[model samples]
Target: MTGGPATPPTPRPPLGPELEVRRLGRFDYARARDLQQELVAQRAAGEVCDQLLLLEHPEVVTLGRRTPEGAADGLDLPLVEIERGGEATWHGPGQLVAYPLFLLPLGRRDLHAYLRDLEEVVLRTLADLGVEGERREGLTGVWAGGHKVCSIGVAVRRWVTWHGLALNVSNDLAGFERFRPCGLEPGVMGRVADLAEVPADDPLLEAHLERHVRGVFGHR
Candidate 1:
């Protein structure tokens, strides 16, 4: 889903620099998107602080501004046009979706640099678990052996980031088969458990993911 064009950065909030993280469980994609829109609106209105929201969505496919037509594959998976920048991708119970609402200083409106920082967070998390991951040129996700383990699509309004990244933790790969992931071939999709040899049903995997995410985005 593609959001509108970047807006001019507003003055920073008075709160000392900090990152706010919230964990939401099993939210619907539409609802989550709505929440993001509301947050962006609130930020524009100067009614809220910079924050990051993490959550999982029920099975849903999202299409971005550049979403490929052939990638839909005639499937009926619910599609929501989002403000984030990217192509089509899947989200389900086992996937982790992070939406960061941050106010970038006026001169710091660099989308490419922000994307690289977000990718680094995921790469560092995967590396903590012994999964070697890297980024491919022209792509915005982390990959393990040519297969994408994480997908990132984001939107910024007035220099405040909204929609964020999604990492496949233990979701069913069958749903992913319904679309060309991030407009890439089916062979490019991957999951955390598939790479780590951990059981998809294991709660420990989620715990570890949460820990790593906290470490990566924690207040310093």
Candidate 2:
């Protein structure tokens, strides 16, 4: 069964203002999670404003709250169990990952709205790249045509958010072959590389996305 109980949104604690943006160029999966925990605590303690971590992680498969019954039965690559609100998804090179450890807006901690806002960042980002990104109603991530170009899964603590999105910019997407992505069957995914204009490589791509997210979420 899917994890996560229906919890009411709480008012955001009065903390330091302004969302801090950090780009970790290239990092491993475990390291990213470690930093998220540290930052989450800081946000909860009012020692820091909201933080947005933009980086790319090495090949890894992450399980979300609704992961299928036997999804993790077998896997050769690294598998991580997270508190996010989705099914299984993968992360690796060429995928832009954003971890927004944000203090939820006061009285606006509605999870569904927050999710749509996250998709807005990517949808706008894709539009800037000359690609048509659309959202499939009843589904979370941004889709171009019918293919999913982005995947979003998030977890919250103390009314603060962690874990964000993974956009397929230039990766081979081999990591997705492991399971039914977001509970969907295989071969339904799309990559930015498939577009005529490939996004800037690595560190550059991270910065490009960072701008759009900040703008969408009011950090700009």
Predicted model with the maximum lDDT: 2
Q: Clash number for every model?
A: 6, 0
Q: Give the TM-score of candidate 1.
A: 0.83
lDDT of 1: 0.72
Backbone clash total, candidate 1: 6
Question: Against the unseen true structure, what C-alpha lDDT does each candidate score?
Answer: 0.72, 0.78
What is the per-residue lDDT of model 2 for residues 1-220, given as tens digits with 9 covering 90 to 100?
Answer: 1222122244333323487888786799998999999999999998988898988888889999899778967888889988888999988887888898988767567677678777877877777778888777577888785688899998889989999899888777667876899988768788887874764453336666777777666664
Per-residue CA lDDT of candidate 1, range 1-220, in tens? 2212122234322222565566777887888888888888887677886677878888888888888666676878787766677888888887878787877665456677667667777777777668988877767888886678888988888878888888887778788786687878877788887777654454425455545545544433
Candidate 1 regions exceeding 4 Å error are 1-16, 197-218
Alpha-carbon TM-score of each model against the true structure:
0.83, 0.88
